[model samples]
Target: MGRYFRRKLLIYGVTFVIAVSINFAVPRLMPGDPVARMLSRNKVANPESSEAMRAYFDNVFGFDVPLWQQYLNYWAALFKGDLGVSVYAFPASVSSVIAGALPYTLALLLPAILLSWIVGNSLGAMAARNKWLDNGVLPVGYVFTAVPYMWLAILLAWVAGVILGWFPVAGGYSFALTPTFSWVFIVDLVHHWFLPFLSLFIVALGGWAIGMRNLVIYELESDYANYLQALGAPRRLVRRYAFRNAMLPQITGLAVALGMVVGGALVTEVVFAYPGLGSLLLSAINNQDFFLLQGILLFIVIGVLVFNFLADVVYVLVDPRTRLGLEGGQS
Candidate 1:
């Protein structure tokens, strides 16, 4: 187990390096000059002043340096936790801007992903055992999983926010309310949070349900299950084993979903105009804010790598087969 985790850690470390390098390169490759965009947005009209400001901005952003030096500086600054200043939200550090939005993204993602997985897997397992439920759940699960995230978000926004007027259509909270710890602010937060959360939850729930249902069915029909039943093991005992065995892949899926939380359901966030990393990323792109975009992408890359590593740890803990396989391979 020690050797197994060490190997996994080494692999993840290499992956993180490659991912960060790509994240750094992709933004620099994007068309247009971010400094120029910033100057234009700030309305720096006089040519002399514009030239002076451009020089100043380029030096400050390290754009004056050669590409190779800039790459090295990026790594150095990254180690110091300096994500650079945001071009779009001028004068604000990229870290601070991302910090402001991180909570909302987490609030939307964590509950939605976790609840969907738990409920979906339960429903799927139950459906596998009952023919009547299988008839109803299978098609519904297919429909829910088939719906695109953005489409569902739009449909929900229209029906729930527009037509019914049950929830606010845009923003993380009511613009009228100042952010505070008061009951009024908290309630208002949940009010705006519900629709986006529901959209994510509903869409994710179906895929998990369908996957779990199929896995459970396959496990129940596997040779071990048949042999157990032939030996007159109780039906309940056999099914319990089947359910546990079927959950392995679902665990992996849940981990991957959690890993992607930092990406913040990009299209859904755009549709709802939610104040999260996804919306921030869109703003960064539109404004050619390379620093901000790099910061966001960095978070996403780290989140995915970290969560995937955790998933491997979890698999080793939960599944005896994984442990046995590793042990045998080592031997």
Candidate 2:
């Protein structure tokens, strides 16, 4: 267990370094200057002639420094928790910008992820049990899963928000209510959250359903499952022992999925105009807000790494053979 934890921590550390490097390198590799992008957004006379702008951009963006020095500075800032200021939302730190938008993302994503787990897994298990259900569900699920998430969001928005008028068309909350930390605020928040949740829920559920059903089916054929059947084990025992073990991979997938829920729903958030990290990321990219973009990407990378590490630990626990292998000798 000690060695296993050490291995996990070492992997995470290596992953973190790679993530940070990519966060810095990818933007620099892309065409166009960050400074120019920032200047373009401003309405200024003789935008190219300002010495102050030149100095600020050169110094802050490291345009004046050696490439290696700039890379070192970038790594230094990570230690200092200085993600730099947003080019668009100028003077505001990227961290603060992300913090402001995270609530809406959580509000939008939490229910969607939860509902997907409950409904999708249940549907998958039922389908796995019934041959007819398996035949019908696999095709329908494949169709839904194959559909682009943004298209689904739009289709649902029009049908539910416009035609039925059951949910809001766009935005995180009503413009009328001032954001506060009171009961009235919470109620308004939930009311506003409904539409985005429904949209994401519909789109996100398919993968889990298909994954779970396949897992359950595969487990049903295992030697232990056959043994249980021969022993006339209770149906519940057969499922709990055999099918549950089969579903371990899906649970690991769920952990990865949950980690991504924080950062991967950018398109959905953009379509809905919901104020979240996803929307923030979209705006940052379009406007070339490099600092904010880097911060968001780093956040996502770290989140995924942490979740993956957790999944590895869970994987070992679920299958003791994994732990035995990691211990470097036969059990």
Worst 10 residues of 2 by lDDT: 39-48
lDDT for residue 99 in candidate 2, whole number 0-100: 89
Per-prediction TM-score to the true structure, in the order listed: 0.97, 0.91
In model 1, state the lDDT of residue 83. Answer: 99
lDDT of 1 by residue, 46-154 (tens): 9999999999999889999999999999999999999999989988999999999999999999999999999999999999999999999999999999999888999
Instruction: Report lDDT (CA) for all predictions.
Output: 0.92, 0.79
Candidate 2 lDDT tens digits, 73-97: 8889889998888876877888899
Q: Which residue runs does candidate 2 get wrong by more than 4 Å? A: 46-49, 131-136, 262-264, 323-331
